[model samples]
Target: MLIPYDQLEPDTLTSLIEDFVSRDGTDNGDDTPQETRVLRVRHALSKGQAVIFFDLESQQCQLMPKHAVPKEFFD
Candidate 1:
């Protein structure tokens, strides 16, 4: 399921983005600051370049590129 980023509370969204960007291997050795990375992700979400996905079985939320998501999810 797709969870609209706008529906999330500001703090919750920030924490989610922070957690996503902070995960090991996410930065790929880049030296970008956490805040910058968070903002970039936020921008991607707003621009429809990325989306928030909620997995039913795992009961976990993930940030993924829009193109990477399965078309069935959009339906």
Candidate 2:
């Protein structure tokens, strides 16, 4: 489901973004500071360039680029 970013608690949003940026291959060794990475994601979310999706089956949350969300997810 498409959960609006504004609905998430501040701490929850921060943690989610931190987890995403912490992934092994996520940054491609850019070595950006954690806060900077988190801010980048925050900006993307605010601008509609990215979204947070919740999978019904797995009950998992995923951070994905706006164009990359599968069509079925929206249905």
Candidate 3:
């Protein structure tokens, strides 16, 4: 269940945007694309777990139990 960031639901996009911004430690209250990393699925884990690598730095974004990614994409 992988999806392009742009294809995410409005609310889902909001959540990810908030998370990304918060994690980056910026609260300027502006949504701007600053050469962000986009994860690509490498492997699928059991029970919805997955191993994704994004960016040249190899950043990982995992969707846990409580937080589930929708199933309809390959990005």
Candidate 4:
């Protein structure tokens, strides 16, 4: 399911974005600060270039590029 970023609390959204940015192989030693990365993710969300996905089976959530999410998910 798609979770609108605006619907989440600011602190909860920040934590979720931080975790998404810090995931394995996400940085590749680029040395960017965590807050900076979080901002980037938020920007993507605002631009509709990225989405938050919640998996029903796993009850887990993560950020994904808009195109990376199947079209069926949106329907």
> Going through the candidates in order, what is the number of backbone clashes in each?
0, 0, 0, 0
Count: clashes, candidate 4: 0
The TM-score of predicted model 2 comes to 0.91
Cα lDDT, all candidates: 0.97, 0.92, 0.39, 0.93
Evaluated against the true structure, the overall lDDT of model 4 is 0.93
lDDT of 4 by residue, 10-74 (tens): 99999999888888999998899988998899999999999999999999999999999999988
Best by TM-score: 1
- TM-score per prediction, in order, is 0.97, 0.91, 0.30, 0.93
Ranked candidates, highest lDDT first: 1, 4, 2, 3
Candidate 2 collision pairs: none
Q: Is candidate 1 or candidate 4 better by lDDT?
A: 1
lDDT of 1 at 31: 100
**Cα displacement (Å) at residue 1, model 3:** 9.0
lDDT of 2: 0.92
List candidate 4 segments past 4 Å from native.
Answer: none
Q: What are the C-alpha RMSDs, in order, of all predicted structures?
A: 0.5, 1.3, 12.8, 0.9
TM-score of model number 1: 0.97
Model 1 misplaced stretches (Cα beyond 4 Å): none
Candidate 1 at 11: error in angstroms?
A: 0.7
